[model samples]
Target chain A: MNTGASSTRRRHSGRIVTALLFIAPWALGFLLLVLYPFAASLYWSFCEYDLLSPPRFVGGANYRRLAHELLNGEGFGRAVWNTAYYAVASVVLSVLAGVGLAVMLSWKVRGQAIYRAIFFLPSVVPTVAAAVLWMWLLDPGGGLVNHWLTAVGLPAPNWFKGVQEALWPPDWWSGRAAFGSKDALVLMSVWGVGNFMIIYLAALGDIPKSLYEAAALDGAGNLRRFWHITLPNLSPVIFFNIVMGVIQAVQAFTQVYLVSEGRGAPAESTLMLSLHIFLAAFQNLEMGYASAIAWMLFVVLLAATAALFHSSRYWVHYQGGSP
Target chain B: MIHDKATFRAHLLLLSAAVLFAAPLVWMLVSAVKPAGQLTQDPYSFWPREWRWQNFADAAAAMPFFRYMRNSLLLAGGTVVGSLFSCTLAAYGFARLRWPGRDLVFGLLIATMLLPWHVTMIPRFLLIKELGLYNSLAALIAPTFLGDAFSIFLLRQFFRTIPEELSEAARLDGLTEWGVCWRIVAPLSKPALLTVGLFQFIAAWNDFSGPMLYLSDPKKFPLAYGLEQFVSSYSDQTHLLLAAAVMFTLPILVLFFIAQKSFMKGVSTTGLKA
Candidate 1:
């Protein structure tokens, strides 16, 4: 009996040792990469470090500057609006377009795989390549889009050069039709919404065909069946993509950097939050201020996620039960 | 049979959407082969006025295109090895073993996914610099060697789906835990492993920011960043620019065709499960 107990304890210790050995790599990563950086960033948000000198305690000065900019519609304010416009518009538009395309792809049809390949190909196109492609396509004077528009005798906005927002033209837009950099970026993102469309199509497959059959038996037409059966089943995925899309858009950097000449040029019209943080830290070496902006973004994201989850209860219907 | 009128309308709408979605790519191909000066000229023809296949050669000559591609492959290959090595071990630990605080630590891993990269970007960069890894491919690849949470999560999910009896049977047959991980569990999870590798490879390949951040030396610039150099200076040479973009995109497109199943599985399983 004594030997058995000792052996059992020994085996238990062996299991613990094995688990530890297995997890060492990730634990190291979590500490060095995630945990330490997280704590350091929070602490630096209050300091005034310039990467060349030691950090000096500034005690809310950076936050105060953020608040001032936020209130005045200046530096940080512009980024907030740019990020909000791009994130909200792109995610919302992608969900709508994704669901529509997904439904179309889900149709019982020929060449389905070919159609899927065509759509999915864009999302996988390298961002640099895509950004360059769009830049030329939407070029103001000699590009394809404007060429076609001018051929049809319509107006073509100076896409990368223009500063006007399409949907909510600012007071400065002044009764002119113009598509700006952010507008172009949003269109570019929607063009790549094929990835999310793939997800929605997958979710659409999980929906029971019986639901649609029952709707049809009740004399419901195609649109009605889609409205009732398809939309509800897809709500969960839509919500998930919305959350992810917002996060992606918030961190969207490369395209914004490339298109706006690394400084959000063309009058800083595309000065997104990520680029703003990049320029502040790396470009100007204002590490503390950049950390402050990053913290602000984190808080906003947490709040946004919480709010979405709160709101999701009403709309996102899980199949088995409520989330 | 399905209604003929509705079917025709559906096909038309779908075909038009396909055309619209594929427009940029088609335009890339068409513009790539257009004669050099013709792009800046009088008439805009949809098809190339002359098939200047020479534009592709010129684009490659205009930049260190092959060198950039080799660097890209190196980064992608290095990240895949690192992620697979670290993540597979971590996943088996989480999935197969009972350890105190395991669940809590796994929770932290998942939460790390949502923490925006911007929050940690500066410190992480500084960390690399302090480690004397800045401006090297290792600066990007080394951290991936530590492990990625998303890959770990995917792998853990797959490892959990694997029956515990297999691990137990291996143990009884005298395999150690590490032996079981490598010899038994790892072999069975090849598809899951491939999915994770594909994700990281695509990520490292398409990454504009990583190469932009860590690698400043033009000699080390991957295609993604190296190609952008053309955008700033030589964008006026639209044919060469388009040709380069097409070439940059072609391999990944072909890779997608080859591994479409793995790619589709990774996206769908992660999305649906989340």
Candidate 2:
């Protein structure tokens, strides 16, 4: 009996060792790539460290500078506002557009697969290529969009050139600006809403047809049925899309970098948080300040995510009980 | 039958949306074949007056297109091999083993996905530089050997779906844990593995920021970054630019067509499960 017990213990220890061996690569990466860098970034946020010199502790200075700039509404403040505008506007629009497209694609129509493929194709285009294509498409002069607008006797806003006239014309049009780079960015984002549409399409497939049939039997029209049955069933996926959309919009950089000509030009109107942090660290060589901005962005994202989760209980419908 | 009017309206809306979404890409392709003079003079033309099929050749000549393509393929291939090797092993450990603190460690792995890349960008860059990989494609590819959080998570999920009886049977046949993972679990998870590989390939192909950060040498620039460089210099050559963009995008578009099922399944599964 003692021999049997000892043998089992030995086997258990062997299994543990084998497991460790299997996990070694990821553990090493988690430590070196993730954990160490995470700690270093937080520490660097408080220290002035250029690539050339050793870090010098300067507590609160970076934060203070960011706060000052944020209040002054020139540098960091512009970025914050621009990021907020882009993230909020793009996320809301994409969610709406994605759901609409997904529903349309889900309809029992001829050539459904072909339509879905056409819609999904754009999202697969590389970000750099897409940005380049859009830049040409939205060029102020000698562009197809402007030419079409001119042919149709409509006003063609200088898409990448003008400062986005806030609230559009007839409401709060300043007359000094037209649809600007951010608006163009929103258009690009909506164009690639296919990714989110795919998720919604999957969720829509999971919804039972009986619910829709019952709603129809009650004399409910298409819109009413969608509002009652489809909307509720889709709430969970909608919630997921909203959370992911916000996060992705906040991190949007490559397209923005390309569109704004790498410096958020045309009046800094398209400068986003990620681009701002990148320019701060890489361009200006202010690693410390950039780290601070990154930390703030992290905190804001966390809070926003947490708040969304909290609010989701009331809105997001679950088939089973809520977790 | 339910509502002919509603269905008709839906098809109409979907067709128009599809056209709107597809117009830019179609324009990119159409403009690529347009002569340089025709592009500026008649930018709104749906069809080119003169088919300048040689523009693609011109664009290819304008840049080190072949070199950039080679670098891109190398990076993508390296990343796929690295991610598959490392992530599969790690995922097996997480899914099949019963080690202490496994759940907690797995939680940490998932949480890593939530951590924004910006937080770790600077220090990671410095770390890569310290490792003497800076300015080389190795700087970008080396990290993939470690493992990625998303790929590991994906593989783990697939591994968990595999029946434990298979592993046990292999073990009873005197196979080691590694043997069981390699000979049993890996074979059953081909679809998942393919999903991970496809994702890694697309990511590597489309990677802009990695090259932007780690690589400064023009010789090592992948097509994604190299194409951007071409843009800055050849901004006036719109037809060439469009041709170049089309060239860069064509392979990915074709891959999407071939692997559409895997791509859609991977995306949808990740979303639903997450």
Candidate 3:
């Protein structure tokens, strides 16, 4: 018995040493790549250093500038409002679209794989390339969209060029503006809902066929069945996607950066907060200010995620039990 | 009768939605084949007046397409092999090995997932510079070659689902721990390996930021980053840009076509796990 116990202990020790060896590279990378940067950003957030200069601590000056000085001035409030609008709207729309697509695809149909392949195709296109493609599509003068509009007895609005007209088109011909403004950002975001579609598709498959049959016998209509059985089953996935989507949306950069020609122009409508941070850090070379912005964004994300989890208990359902 | 009607309605809705979803890509393909002047002149048209098949040839000629293809393949291939090996080793340790502070270490690994890449962008760039691996395919492939927290977590969960008896049987045959891992465990975990490989390949293939940040040499750039170069210079040249974009995405398109069954299965299974 004593020998068995000794052998067990020896085995654990051996495993521990081997585990250490296997994890060493990642641990080293975490230190050099992650931990150091995280701590450095925290420290640098308080300073007022350009990239060229040695950082000097100024104690909340950067934060104060962001809150008080910058907020008081031009386009800052507009940017805050615009980014929040874009992030929140995009997340909600994309989730709806994704779930809707998944539900539609879940039905027994011919060529489901073909549809899946087609839907999934656009996402494989690199974001930079996608942006370039869209820029041509949305071009104001002599673009296909505008050309079609004019050909069909409609006025073509200058998209991505006219700020006020882009956002809220004057109600002359049509009462509703279909596209343009920062809405293009939301539209662009929806185009890449393929990942979310795949997630929802998986979740949809997990819903037992028997549940639907039972619901059918109970005289639950398609809409009712979806609301009663499908919605609750999918709530967990919905919550997860929401949290991830919001986090990703808030940090949205590449699309806006590539699309708006690095200016965030047509009245700074497309400058997301992360793009703001990038402009501050790289373009303006205000490393310290960017650090402050990043920390603030990080805190916002953490708080938002926590709030989502807190609220999820009320709506999100699980099959087994809540954690 | 109502059930049949409902089914018909469902099929119709799905067909319309699928067409709408696929419209953008269809437009992209059409734009690629259209003449440059016509593209700028008619950007959103479904059908082009004049088809310019040579636009692809021209775009290919303008860029070092073959070289970029080779670089992307090597980078993505290297990333797949390295990540599979390193991540599998780490995951095996996490899933199977019993040790002090194992939970704590695993928690730290999960925490690493939330550490945004944007935050470490500059510092990682500095580290790569220090290593003198900048301006080569090494820069594109090396940072990711080590391991990823996400991939490790995914594979660890998979390894955990596997039966322990297989390893014990291999051990009884006088196989070392590593031997059991290789000889028994890997062969049995084809699904998980395919999942990891497909994801890593897609990610490494679509990766633009890594190459954009590290590679100064155009010849060393991957297709994604190479396409970005054309975007900067030829934003107005819609046809050429679309042609280049189409060329950049063709590999992934081909990959998906070839591995469609396995890829969807892998993704869906992993989605459930996540």
Write model 3 residue lDDT over A95-116, tens digit each, in one string: 8998998888888867887878
lDDT per residue (tens digit) for residues A1-323 in model 1: 99999999998888789899898998899899888999998989999999898889899999999999999988899999999999988988999898989999999888889898898888888889999999888989778899888888877888887887886645435646578888899999999887788899999999998998888889998889888889889999899999988888888998899889898878889999999999999989999999999999999999999999999999988888994
Candidate DockQ scores, in order: 0.66, 0.67, 0.49
Tell me the deviation in Å of residue A314 in model 3. 1.4
Give the per-residue lDDT of model 1 (tens digit) for B1-274: 5588778888998899999988889878888998987788843678777899999999999999999999999999999999999999999999999988899988988899989999999999999899999999999899988999889999999999888899899989999888999999999999999889888888889899988889889999889899998778796788889899999999888889999988888888785211
- Model 1: lDDT equals 0.89
Local accuracy of candidate 2 as per-residue lDDT tens digits, A1-323: 99999999999999889999999988999999999999999999999988889999999999999999999998889999989898988998998998999989888889998998898888889999999998888888877888887788767888878676443343435444457789899889989887888999999999999998888889998889999889988999999889988988898889999988898888998889899999999999999999999999999999999999999999998988786
Flag clash pairs in model 3.
Answer: A144-B43, A144-B44
> Clashes in model 2: which pairs?
none
Clash number for each model: 0, 0, 2
Order the numbered candidates by lDDT, best leading. Answer: 2, 1, 3
Pairs with steric clashes in candidate 1:
none
As a whole number from 0 to 100, the lDDT of residue B22 in candidate 2 is 87
- Chain A vs. true chain A, TM-score per model, equals 0.96, 0.95, 0.90
Q: How high a TM-score does candidate 3 get?
A: 0.91
* Regions more than 4 Å wrong, model 1: A169-177, B272-274
**Number of the top lDDT candidate:** 2
Worst 10 residues of 1 chain A by lDDT: A168-177
Can you tell me which runs of candidate 2 are displaced by over 4 Å? A165-177, B1-4, B272-274
